[model samples]
Target: MTSENTIKNQLPDAISARVRSAKLSEGVATLVMDATGLARPQAEALEADLRGALEGAEGVSEVRVAMMADKVKRPIIAVGSGKGGVGKSTLTANLAVSLARAGYKVGVVDADIYGPSQPTLLDPSGQKPKARDKQLIAVDSEFGVKLLSTGHMIEPGKAIAWRGPMTGGALTQMMEADWGDTELLLIDLPPGTGDIQLTMIQKFKPDGAVVVSTPQDLSLIDAARAMDLFRQAHVPIIGLVENMAGYMCPHCGEISDPFGTGGAQAAAGQLEETFLGRIPLAMEIRVSSDTGQPLAAGDTPQGQAFAGIARKVSDWLKAKGSHG
Candidate 1:
């Protein structure tokens, strides 16, 4: 008595929506399975489950599952800073590399129209992205990460003094790239809440945002404003990261806190937000990052710091259970 409709109703609730069509003929069951947004392992498991369920049904001798994945909507995570000097862009680069190293398919969009520094950090050679079918192509980096930045299209050291519409258009072009298999797209937003930020919220609608700030009251105040922007737009605030919390002198072995640490954590506590972690003010980190070599791509102390932060962010998003 088992038929196509019966088998579909018996399919797991997880992939029920993916059942495009099903048919049964001569004791052979055929199913059209949509695996969009599913990871490779997940797709494989789904196929097995479908086959088992169909074969176990009455009158079903063989089962065939044709798996297909439609174009998936990549989740966006916007990383913003209160002010420009809090090393937000640098953190974005390292975080992307860390996530990629952890086997996550990740890409970055340098959405900082005013000051696009990601090209220097990710692609020092100033490589330009090629276009096909009127869509931009993402440049592959050495750390197994993909990147699209306004810096790659503009001249170095030149200011991008454009109006709101121009800036929004550029951001659109960078985002419309061929980011194949990229599950997570990290947008390195420009400093503060402005037209660019508003455009992103209104158009792209990010899944969440991570605010970066230094361990100082001034920067923390700005960071609070940035978080409020995302909150107003109904975007979830993933957490806050305190950068430049401490600095150690390699020559004299002296530790210093010139920026007066813990301000960002205290701010997060007051706002009842999750305080992700901190990054130290290390000279090696600066040198390595500025030279197109992200510390998070290597096995060093600074790299571990960035990796730790990446894991927390990644886990936080995964807990939401929306993405595969």
Candidate 2:
């Protein structure tokens, strides 16, 4: 074969060998990995190999992994869960708020279309987003974070009936909304490892992702799946967070692991990503979230938790620089 043909033939092998499979769709070549049993070191090793291979391929305009679910303008860090109800939304809200308060222009796209929690977690009394020249304008929370959510578009009851195409379309619109000079966009993805999740990552092409889970075996298992999703999407897995890891009692001022702690941290180690931090199960976090006010907006335990996470995230981003 000619040298050009030889290069082309070698490209597919380099990519497919690193992943479970590789395919070209819509002029974009993508690599998908099962990544079921691989530990973090193995995954990273595989990713490095794949990156090197793709970097040498000719005629490859874009190479995407099958795991990123959203297409975003800025560097986006996704906060995802394997399943729902592990405080992913709460953590996302507070983290975004904390980042915004720490002098970064932050925007949050609540990609949880089926359960748009940011509307409730951000500010219940907050005004809906406005459209300028047919483009949606993200609303600003009291803490100065720009926000967009499916919650602002459809009623909660009707959102359940939205089909996959509708969800994808809405997510595209929300993600593409006018964030207005934001430095970072934190996406609060819907729970699951399904098509919706995959599509969101591919479209948004987030810079990295953070998985959130409670410290239970079941939640950790799901978090592993979530991490795998990002891995497959070829998006970098930034870290994992153990939410509701422990609880601080208000009456006696003591700590207890209602959910049995450390599972998430262990999982992150196994996966070879950084273990971001833990958020204790505090009544204050729940109350503050429910009231459309996150704990990170003020001087509270929850605020400190989010602030620390934000700092870590900002530091990491500073180190990585810009993607596009």
Candidate 3:
């Protein structure tokens, strides 16, 4: 007879740690294992491994394993800007790629209904997401980030002339998609405080917001309004990112402030928010984005800039998790 104690002791440390309970009776082994934080494939592999480990045990003819995992609430981060042409979408794409590079399962929701550009930035292959059981699946990008965008749903270059309620409905559909095991979602909100923004705030409240702007007075003013929207809705401001802060001449290697410098940092200080970092107005960034290869996927200085910002955001997330 195989005793329960003997069976428990025989489990590998990795397996035993997850085993909440184990029993052997009548030539059968039963196990209750916690699969917390594991994705479906991982949990399935664990089950197979557990069965394999027990199959050869004395007096064990059958193995039954029950896997239980706590439901994980995925955090949503809104990447917003007060006005268009500030590189908010580009920043969102890079941030998602950088976070994915840092071992996070991240997803991007291109909530810019009128101007869905993530498909072009992240999934240049133009692969449309499939639907399963009426739930839209996220399309996988080469950079390890999953994506759901209005660009995928509609034909290429088609203009979206949707009313507030209609656009809001579309936002809801993307937000409630079947994102498997995605721990974080970066929503690239449309520019300005419009219907989509309000729908995002009221329907699926984000855990935090990252406001993007150029380091110019005009852009900073709009960025402030965007920040105020999130503040009014009680969404925490993760920080501010100064995009297009400076331009570097590729040939001459001279640096110049095309949009002026440090305006966003000053604005962040005035608003009592963290200044995440700046992304230079680099042609490399623009080219990489246009080609659907995020610069953050590389290790160049420009890539490192996005990576640095991602590190700060990751640190903030860790701190938030620790507090909870």
TM-score of each: 0.80, 0.75, 0.84
lDDT of 3 by residue, 1-324 (tens): 346676778778898889888788888888889998786578899898888889987778989889998777788999999999999999999999999999899999999999999999999999989887788888889999999998998899889888888888888888888777788999999999988999999989999999999999999999999999999999999999999988888789899998999999999999999999999999999999999999999999999999999999999899889212
Higher-scoring candidate on TM-score, 1 or 2: 1
Per-model clash counts, in order, read 0, 17, 0
Using lDDT as the yardstick, the better of models 1 and 2 is 1
The sequence of per-residue lDDT tens digits that candidate 2 reaches over residues 3-80 is 333334555564454454566544456666544434334556666666576654665656666432123347888889
Lowest-scoring 10 consecutive residues by lDDT in candidate 2?
64-73
Query: What ordering of candidates by lDDT runs from best to worst?
Result: 3, 1, 2
lDDT of 3 at 68: 94
**Which lDDT values do the candidates have, in the order given?**
0.88, 0.78, 0.91
Q: What shift in Å separates residue 264 of candidate 2 from its native position after superposition?
A: 1.2
Error of 3 at 153 (Å): 1.3
